[model samples]
Target: MEPVMPKDPEVHSAPAAVEMSEAAAANEEDPAHPETMAFCPTGWLPHGHRCFKLVSSDRWGSVEENCAALDGDLAGAETMDDYNDLHTLAQFFGHTYYWIGGFYFQGVWRWIDGSRFIYNNWHSQNSASSYPCIALRGAGGWVNTNCGYSYPAICVKRAC
Candidate 1:
């Protein structure tokens, strides 16, 4: 199924309901620590306290499973910085759309890593039941689409 795009492509503002955590805010303000780079494997980008990498395209479930095999899960964006970093990384790797860790479950959207799903930049709020998986658009904004669709994905693990 084709992902739905917002009427105004430039409307990519995140909802103001969520506040960035103190730790995340601090990390965003500070540059990556030198030691953090050593923790990330070659090809993985080190940011804040985590390492992120873009994986090959596949169905959401398969992509998630592939991430798990690498000792991580699909990436989650707890802050606007985190979201933008993920988007930038995917774009850098030339992927127009890629899966993240967001999913609608039991009426609530949750990150696969169990982080709170507070921050969002949805292009349009589609019915969660029909489009349960979340993918990030390289141009900007998020899209809700079927989990079965194949797309590249970002995987994140702690840099420690």
Candidate 2:
């Protein structure tokens, strides 16, 4: 399958074109409705059933904090489609270490949202470390890193 890339880095949406058109019109009518803002907010990118946003580099804690303030959490991908969407967004901005939701806590990898820790694309090296958080590596993989180090982040939440 061809990789999906956003024509504009500032926005993206799921492939449901007709539904999106209807939603857009409804959004015009009732801008405050949660349904209207469910898929993708004004500046966020949408894929499948979630919306994503890439924030500027900051310490891991701060990044996650910002996402929480916006009602999101650090991004996590359990499927290839999810990974592809996030990877494409990262490519658009040329970011290498965007913080994701996975973290090493209590001897296992877990998502910040408490979702089951399932798929992973860790780089083949010293990736299995005691670092508290994981960051997406350049291109399309992951690396363990210090949570205190400043790095960009990918925030994600359900699409309503």
Candidate 3:
């Protein structure tokens, strides 16, 4: 299904992680304390206040599906610092390019999860046409692409 466009493109903030901590704290095998539960899910790696999971795929939809299944959305780097961190992580995974959450809809670039479109790392060639999705190059640049094209994805969500 195509993503729903918000009537007004307000910035989206990640849900607070305290809720996740509370949930995990309820599980006996899940650390038993809020402080200890701050880590990301078992297989996911942590950076700052978020957890990111690299899901390998050659298809954008598959990557979106995987991220949704984990109760997260595609990683949207709203700051240069975030882009740097995600870029570093993607490099470690040996990916030359990886899907992020931004996409063009109705001529506007908006994050899939509705986060603020506060920053950009676009390559000079990225601004050309109607490609509706974005991928981050390993060198920390972004390019637009046809949404149907395949690429690995970085799923991101609140840590813990």
Largest lDDT belongs to which candidate?
1
Candidate 3 steric clashes: 2
Model 2 C-alpha lDDT per residue in residues 11-60, reported as the tens digit of each score:
22212112234544233324454443445665566555677777767778
The Cα local distance difference test for each model comes to: 0.72, 0.66, 0.67
List candidate 3 segments past 4 Å from native: 1-38, 126-129
Model 2: weakest 10-residue lDDT segment is 10-19
Indicate the TM-score of model 3: 0.71
Give the per-residue Cα lDDT of candidate 3 at 93.
Answer: 62
The better-scoring model by lDDT among 1 and 3 is: 1
TM-score attained by model 2: 0.70
lDDT tens digits, residue span 41-121, model 1: 555566656877767777899989989998888998878988888877766656567789999988889899666588888
7 Cα displacement, candidate 2 (Å) = 29
Sort by TM-score, top down from the best: 1, 3, 2
lDDT of 3: 0.67
* Residue lDDT tens for model 3, 1-160: 3232111111122121223234433332244434434456766665566777777654566678889999988988788888888888767666567778887766678888776578888763344244667887766688777666666788998875
Scored by Cα lDDT, where does model 1 land? Answer: 0.72
Report clashes for each candidate as comma-separated counts: 0, 0, 2
